[model samples]
Target: MRILSLILALSFFLSACETVKGVGRDVESAGEAMDDAIND
Candidate 1:
């Protein structure tokens, strides 16, 4: 039972990390697009 709880906690943590990474990528792309528009 203890091992299962630990596994679940780790899985949730990993999922959150993935979501945060995705958001970071999206923000980076948005910044790049804005820069291109401003320069053009």
Candidate 2:
């Protein structure tokens, strides 16, 4: 039972990390697009 709980918690933490990374990439892309528009 403890092992299962540990596994669940680890999975949640990994998924949250991936979600944050994805959001960071999206924000970076948006910033680049805005920069391009301004430069053009």
lDDT of each: 1.00, 1.00
TM-score of 2: 0.92
Candidate 2 C-alpha RMSD relative to the actual structure:
0.5
The digit string of per-residue lDDT tens for model 1 on 1-40 reads 9999999999999999999999999999999999999999
RMSD of every prediction: 0.5, 0.5
| Model 2 poorest ten-residue lDDT run | 1-10
Q: What TM-score would every model get versus the actual structure?
A: 0.93, 0.92
Best by TM-score: 1
Instruction: In model 1, state the lDDT of residue 22.
Output: 100
